[model samples]
Target chain A: MKKYIWDGIFKNNPVLVLMIGLCPTVAVSTTVQNALGMGVAVLFVLTMSNLTISLLRPMVPESIRIPIFIIVISTFVTITDYVMHAYAPAIHKNLGIFVPLIVVNCIILGRAEAFASKHTPLPAILDGIGSGIGFTLAILGMAIIRELLGSGKLAGHIVLGTKFAATPILFFSLPPGAFLAIAVLIALTRLRK
Target chain B: MIRMIRSLVLVCVVAAGLLSWVYLFTKDRIEEDTRQKVRANLVELLGDTTLTFKPVIPDTLWEFYRDTTKLGIIFRSYGKGYGGPIPVLVALSMDTTILAIRPATPAEGLKETPGLGTKVTEPDFTNQFKNKKPSQIKLKKDGGEIDAITGATISSRGVVEAVQVGIAKYLKYLR
Candidate 1:
């Protein structure tokens, strides 16, 4: 049980160490606030999906279990999408297709198939929370570097200079910035050991 | 056998129940939120507060056509952008002048660096369209007005083109 959590959080993070779900991880990492907003959304979906899948494992037949898991995860995603669209439309708009793409996120579904189906419900939930944190940490780290150097702002405020937006090295906020940031973050985390 | 069937039915019911709970809780907030964002966008465009949302149109796709008297307008226009469609709002004065324009999805999901294409959201870029017409619109190189954000010609052009479509529609709707 602890092994699944340690593996998710540090030993094998889905984002930083494993480098999964790279799209939203880098896209929303522009601001700490955005990163956190997206992170919590993923966290909520992952935790609930994991819990529901685990609780239903006993009744799920092997032949149709994958289909059942998808329907369950997507239902939670649609629920999350609707809530975000209503309550946090800005982030909702910003996250865009990636939110729907959560249905295809292997991290959530993979755990459901591998660990949650076999494990006790409590362990599955903890594993979900730990991995959710791991993903959040990776995205937040990318956001810090990106926001600081990309636009020279912390949240939306100018911490570097008012002209930071006008300076060169404008690559920080672009899409490619996400790829490079993730690679560097991955390498740094790799070197941390 | 009976126990297994009962358990599956129980889980399905719980899932349905949870989904309904989520929907009920979200229904009001979602409506209020959209109203709030549109309200903010309208306020930014019209610069009028007391002019309350006159539900001039029954749909979310807000459009207004005025007679001798002025009416409010809210409509969306899409532009060719780097990644995909960029949604732009055209707010108008009944007299045919543009009151304000807001760019949605600045870079159209392109992962371009911030402070570059992202600057399209900045006041300087979007705010330039204020009170301007389609004729006055063009990149500085083309000799009309508004300078393109450096290293972001595609994004700048997207905003320019989106504004043009909105104006054309606004004109047609008035006529």
Candidate 2:
């Protein structure tokens, strides 16, 4: 049980190890706030979809399992979209199409097929949570580095202070910066292993 | 095959039911949020929360009034930008001098490139339009007073043209 949770964080870390769901990781990690928002949204969708898929696994016919999983996942994504837009309009606006695009995130669908469809509800949820945490940590790390170097701000606050006053390296805030940060992070993880 | 079809139908029906419930629950709040944001933007642009807005053209143009006195007018305009149409909200006082201008937010479908073109929405860019006449509303390169963003000439130009064209179309309504 513990292994199910820990494996996702350390062994099969989604962004660092599994490399699924990279689109949002790169797109929204420009800001730590955005990264956290995306992380939480993914967590909720993943956990709920995992639970629903596990519960329905026995009854879901083998021939049509993929489509049923999609139906379930998309339902949860839509719910998350509505709830976020209603309550967290600022972050919802910042996230833009990425919120709706969550329906197609491979992590949720991957788990549904590999873990949730076979596991009991409890373990399926734990795996969902573990994967979610792993994803969040990876993206959050990227956001901190990107936001700090790219804009000299941390969660929108100027942490580097006015004294440090060289113009921020704008490269860290663009798409190439996202790619470079991810590559360096992956390399560091590999070195540690 | 029969079982597969049955299960798929059942899952879809259940999903649809759940989605409809959520949609119904959130619909009103979403609309209210939008209205509140528009009001806030109007207040910010006009710099006066006390002013009441009367629609001159029902979502296209508005007239701001403080009691019996007419304050100014605000209208929507669009600029052809790199990403797509950039909607701009422009406010002009009774004399036809610009009061303030704002670009559509990302939520309102402004799709300029983040950190580059999106800077056009920032105050540094939008504030340039304030207190300027329509004739002065062009990028410095085009022999006008406003300056374009360092790397976002297209977006900056879009807002300038949007305000220019908007003023041309809506200024007559002020009189």
Candidate 3:
């Protein structure tokens, strides 16, 4: 149990170690608020999809398993999208097309194919949770640096005051800045290893 | 082969059932929320006066009155932006001048590129339309009064075009 948790969250972190879902991690990590929003949505979709796929693993035939898993994952993604659109419309709008794009987030599908299809339901659920958290934490690190430098705000509140906020390093909020931030973080993590 | 088909069908049916239940649960709330959002946006733009909304075209033009006095008309305009459709909400005074022009939902509608075209949502861009007549709404490069966003001439033009056409329609409809 602990092994699965440790495996997904740290040792085999999806964003950092496995490097599967970098698209959204970079695209939406401009702000702490947005990163958190994406993280929560991914968490819900991942856990639900993983659980459903694991339970259906036996009945799902090998030849048609990939398509079947996709169907199951998309079902959960649509549910998450609608629920968020209905209730948390602000986050939905901010996240934009990425909500539906969760169907292809890769982390969710990767886990479904690699872990969920072969693992028990409980282990699959844990993997989903751990990987989701790992992804969230990884993006949060990038968001903190980006938001702090890019906008001088922490979750929309002014943190750096007039001095830094006046002439914010706008580069940090753009795509290139996302890459720079992630590269530096990845380098730091490598130093520890 | 038959077993494969059966398994696929069973999985699909179960997934469909679960999703349908969610759709049923959220349908009304989503509808209510959308209407409420549009209403809130209207109230925010028009202010807390005794404004009544009468749909001229239901989602296109709405006739709003403040305490039996005709205030103005609120209508939606679509601009073909770089990203896609940029929907702007235009409020015109009874005299045909723009009272306010805001992004329709404030968040959605404009999927303009981040930093460049997306600057269309910034007050520096949208604020240029406030109180301006349609004739004065075009970009400076096009011999109009407005200034285009740096490096985003197309997106700037899109907003102006949407507002210009929208006001023309409003005038024609009024006539």
Candidate 4:
């Protein structure tokens, strides 16, 4: 029971362990604020979609379950998209295309199939939260490293003063830098375990 | 199967209802947000929030005014940038000298390569356009005054062309 929560968070971590949803992880993690925004958005979608799928598991047929799951997940993703666009336009702009692409984010749909459909509603929601946290933690780590080393800023605030801020590594802020940072974090995670 | 169809229908109906509720709830707020944003951008560019905006082409050209006195008209033009269409806002002086150029939209979605072409939205790049005549809006490489961003000459040229062409077309309407 407890393993459901722990596994997704640490042992079977989506980004670091399973390597799912790497697109947004690499793309949006350029800043800590972006990472947190993406994380919260994913968390909401995952939890709601998982809950819906779990509640509908019985009525849904086996052969057509995947499409049904996608509908439920996309419904939640669209809700998140509209809500963010209305309220948090800054984050909405930064996230850009990735916000709509959350429909295809495997973590949301993967949990729906693997856990939500098979489990009861309460446990399914828990699994969703667990996986969401795991994904958030992973991306936050990536963002912290990328923002600090790449741009010398933390959550859009200047941290490195001016001397070091002028010529930040610059490499860490680019796509290659996302790869390098994630790799180092993954390795460190492995070492800690 | 009938069961599958029934289940899909039921789920879709529920999803539609929920989505409609959310959309209806946010429609006015979203519209207000857009209005506020455009108003704020106008204030930032013109340095005056009290000016009245009389739209000549709704979202494209507007005659700004302070009480009954005319200040200047603001023009918005879209440039075919390296990533996509970059929306450049140009506030022209009485003679159409470029008063200021702002990206007018967040450039993140444009997918321009980061650290280079995307810098077009940065004030450091856009500030170069301030007070330049339409003839001088070209890149230094093209014998004009503007300095092209390193490794992003295409984007730099895009902005120049957008402003030059946009200004040329709108200049006739200013009178």
> Number of clashing residue pairs in every model?
8, 0, 0, 0
Candidate with the greatest DockQ versus the true structure: 2
The per-residue C-alpha lDDT of model 2 at residue B151 equals 89
The lDDT leader among the candidates is 2
Q: What is the TM-score of each candidate against the true structure?
A: 0.73, 0.82, 0.85, 0.84
Error of 4 at A1 (Å): 3.5
Candidate 2 ranges beyond 4 A from true positions:
A157-161, A165-167, B55-59, B81-83, B93-98, B105-175
Q: After superposition, how far is residue B33 of candidate 1 from its true place, in Å?
A: 0.8
Tens digits of per-residue lDDT for model 2 on B45-150? 8788889988778667989999978988999999988899999999999999998998997767899998899998899888888898888988999999999999
Across residues B93-149, which tens digit of lDDT does each residue of candidate 4 receive?
777778888774444235566778888888889899988888888899899999999
Q: Which ranking of candidates, highest DockQ first?
A: 2, 4, 3, 1
Task: List clashing residue pairs in candidate 3.
Answer: none
* CAPRI band for model 4: medium
Residue pairs clashing in model 1 are: A173-B113, A173-B114, A174-B111, A174-B112, A174-B113, A174-B114, A175-B111, A175-B112
Lowest lDDT 10-mer window, candidate 1 chain B?
Answer: B59-68
- Write model 1 residue lDDT over A128-180, tens digit each, in one string: 88888889888899898898888888878788877765682568788898888
Lowest summed lDDT across 10 adjacent residues in model 3 chain B is found at B102-111
Better of 1 and 3 by TM-score: 3
For residues B62-170, write the lDDT of model 1, one tens digit per residue: 5543343447566677677665666777776666666677776443443334667667777888888788766888888878788899898888888778778766755
Docking class of 2: medium
Question: What are the per-residue Cα lDDT tens digits for candidate 4 across A25-44?
Answer: 99999999999999999999
lDDT of 3 by residue, A1-193 (tens): 9788778878888988888899999999999988998999888989888998999987888999988988998998899888998888788778988889999989999999999999999999999999989888999999999999998999998899978988999999999999999999888777878
Question: What's model 4's lDDT at A128?
Answer: 90
**Candidate 4 TM-score, C-alpha based:** 0.84
Off by over 4 Å in 4: A156-167, B80-84, B93-97, B103-157, B167-175
